[model samples]
Target: MSYPTISFSGGSIDRADYIRTDPAKLEELKDWRARLVKLDGLDPVLTPQNELEWGSLADCPPGADLVFLGLRDGRACFAAVPEAGDAGALQMGSRARAAMGILGHDDLGIYGMARSLVDWHARHRFCAQCGAPTQLAKGGWQRDCGACKAQHFPRVDPVTIMLVEHGGNLLLGRQPRFPAGFYSALAGFVEPGETIEGAVAREVLEEAGVTVRDVSYVASQPWPFPSQLMVGCHAFANETELTVDRTELEDARWFSRAEVVDALTGAQGAAFTPPPPQAIAHQLLKWWLQR
Candidate 1:
């Protein structure tokens, strides 16, 4: 029996496709009269900490913006924003710090969007068209420069994470900063002008010196640590010989199914376990094992 890549089950909610393109929904969200509220943690709905009590398209503060991510249940789903300084402060608080490990996908999505938008606003305070400060427009979806009339939108970065398997063993590696015995799948930011498959192959070869074939998409997760979407994949190894790049990996090896099972079950003497359930890496490994 071979070790399997884990799969995400609980957090895998199929966001319906209709939310993005429907004109009515978009119009409703874009309406100036719509009500938008911010929540601290999972509180139902609380007023925003800023002075802009009501949602508006024209007066969002610098370093404050929203990422309009379509609709959830016909109500516009958005990543709300506050000041970047405030975000950092929140992270330093005991509650926020504790939530980092406990937050689910939805919570992480919100946090990511909020933080990234704030960062974007911080950097884009001045318009690209004319070096003048821009104003938030369209419910925080776009920013407009008052001087030259330029608009900017939020961005999402794509990253690839893959589980590589050959024969009955799955490949895993530990980073220099990782705790002893800790290992996860190889991952890297997807370079510009490269497909997901290309990124996976490239990352595998570069980090583990392993040749891969039959690359297959597994799943994707929104990792908002700073606005990244993790594209999970599984690739069959064409060559099993290990030659880890010391600069990237402190250690690398193949783990059998039984070994992985023991680690997951916390049996004595097992190596470090995967990340918490909130992480896609854990899901990927769980999915692989069940299959």
Candidate 2:
């Protein structure tokens, strides 16, 4: 099936690797014409119209670390890492979800990049190798440790999120922190040296004690809650029996396609609240239904 336009996947900006690698090119873009994506500490700053707000470098306080967020329509873009000692927004998670809901797919993609890079720089201020302070390099793409000559870069952890299907029904589960009656596809981080398919199988078995096979890739999304690549997939459950791990999920059950349709469409008396549109879990369910 042709993939849908997943959230955080369709930015029009050109990530100028050339400028990042070349000091001269990077410097040229730091002029007044360059634009900056404003941030409230670690959170995004939106306009009154719910659009991504832009500012000039003049708005950035002196000595703030500016991360180059590539070129938007040939104009350089940047985001300032929140200054040190600034407290994080108390409602950061909810505010970010609200932004994702109102933002266009392209704008969401841009915010994803900016948030991840800015947060990475803020957290990685020191070299892991030598415990020495590091300096921004490669237009904020890399951190250089002068003491040990070590290089650090932003990382995106990969997570496998799958919809397990069997006998024309879809398997779904709810976590403890999720809203009451809310359920979504099961997901877990892909451990080191594990293939995507292998991870899917392993996660399904561990979380719900259901062995899955025929694991196949679907669409993917960039989830920038600290930078993660959500790998969506479809897998076939060999058996319907479930041994739910209570620690990971409050409950696990197989739901008919009709129930899923009701949950997704918000029909009255739906079985459970479906995952939000911005979530890869929601996309996975849509893909399964479309197929």
Candidate 3:
């Protein structure tokens, strides 16, 4: 079996730690450098600006600031920047979203970090314990509620995306929202109280009515579309018969390795193409095909 090579490099670091540190130095630097982003009427968020002129400014609200999970040398680094506007839609003004779709490997790294952390801050404005709003504390690493005195941290939802193979063929499915004739691996969110292996088994069964065995962990990616960490896996299919759940998938079937190769290379037909390489699903398929 020959699988395509995923763009993952061994030296890449997961920058989670640095982003959680004290941003006092970062803030001081920003004070001098004037980091800012200007929103244009709020329909779609405007593009992000990394640097701007720091004018006479008021004190930032306790929790009102931008936090970035920077990856240096492939490890996670957490840092906070001044939150200018709604962190969730801050990139709406930028072309980053559309760029990721068209530019695969190169675009995935930075854009993924920016979008996810910003979204995390957006949804975590208020403390879950008490109704009192929280303030950004610990350099944007935490939120502290003034009323209840509770601490809140950023969260990442785990999802399992698998490539199920049986008898030299891989199972693929298409959701209604996907482009016409586009098909990819079966995936779903990991349910509460379930393990990654359990989630992979359950999602394949639920979405495609296929039973899987010999589940193996492959790789993982940070999909920051609202803060999700996608765990990629390869599962051995016990049964090839696919009973598609129409509610979840428009169609489901098994494709030969050769056919998948053609589809991926755009040799079989122009209509069929996997998702951009930034997506774990696409990377999973690429890995499987190269095997």
Candidate 4:
């Protein structure tokens, strides 16, 4: 029996790290039936057919940087950047969320990987150590500096997003940038020395002025708007009333389970709405409501 994976988490792809380093395998990669994802200025190109859009290795521009992504259905998958001189009507499109309806979950996840990696490479063209130009190595997974022989890999920031509960009520807050009448579980970035539990409690108290305990993990998601891992959790608030920190949140309040249920189900007289299913916050809310 197969268990359900998190949204935007699972793909039927093997990363093939061992094969990525093999010269013979690299030659074979150029011949396999492959799916090519190209980023034209951070947007993925999609075919009119509404599929992920594949291209032939022979069609790839000469001397283009190709990164072996993985093997999908026993076929190779690669990510590349279009050449400035190549002439093709590459239809530029929005990121995954904007085009979620047409894209598969695995496609979205793979797109996230490609976007994160390509963006990282663009940002770290030079070595942090020795200030030397770095070359792409390990099939776009690693960068090497000839000056210092230093190697750098892509970095992923971790953020903790947790829903706080007290008694039968759930605590949620909204930032000024959020849409009106929309709120989500409070979240903050995990500091270098802080644990996930510590970040959860700290964020709750800092944002809502509510102390929390009994922190527990719910799930995690790969948020690739520049590469972040969202750590989802549930915590029990010791207080019911909220002292909203105006700087962090526009307002915060506790909502009864009935109110949340109404909001989630789009019942009449609903006052607020949570995030969409594409986000881990939505999954956390569903888990909490089901319990």
- Best-fitting candidate, scored by lDDT: 2
Estimate the TM-score of every prediction: 0.71, 0.96, 0.76, 0.89
- All candidates in order of TM-score, best leading: 2, 4, 3, 1
State the lDDT of candidate 3 residue by residue for 1-291, as single tens digits.
Answer: 544444322223344454446466445534433322221222112234332111222322344464534444432233333344244521233454454444335334544555455556666777788678887765556778999899887777888989999999999899997878888888899998999999999999999888899999988876555567778899999988888999999999888887878877878464367776656788787788767
Residue pairs that clash (backbone atoms under 3 angstroms), model 2: none
TM-score (C-alpha) between model 1 and the true structure: 0.71
lDDT by residue (1-291, candidate 4, tens digit) is 222255657666788899867867776777747667755556666777665677767656577677778887788887774433212211223455466567778877787777677767767778998899988888889889999999999878999999888888888889997888998889989998999999998888888888999999888988767678889999998878788899989989888899888888888779798887777887787788878
Compare candidates 3 and 4 on lDDT and give the better one: 4
What TM-score number comes out for model 4?
Answer: 0.89
| Candidate models: Cα lDDT each | 0.66, 0.88, 0.64, 0.78
Error of 3 at 191 (Å): 1.1
Residue clash pairs of candidate 4: none
Clashes of each: 10, 0, 35, 0
**Model 1, span 216-242: residue lDDT tens:** 988887654445778989999998898
Tell me how candidate 4 scores on lDDT: 0.78
**Which regions of candidate 1 are displaced past 4 Å?**
1-80, 85-97, 104-109, 128-131
lDDT of 2 at 208: 100
User: What does candidate 3 score on TM?
Assistant: 0.76
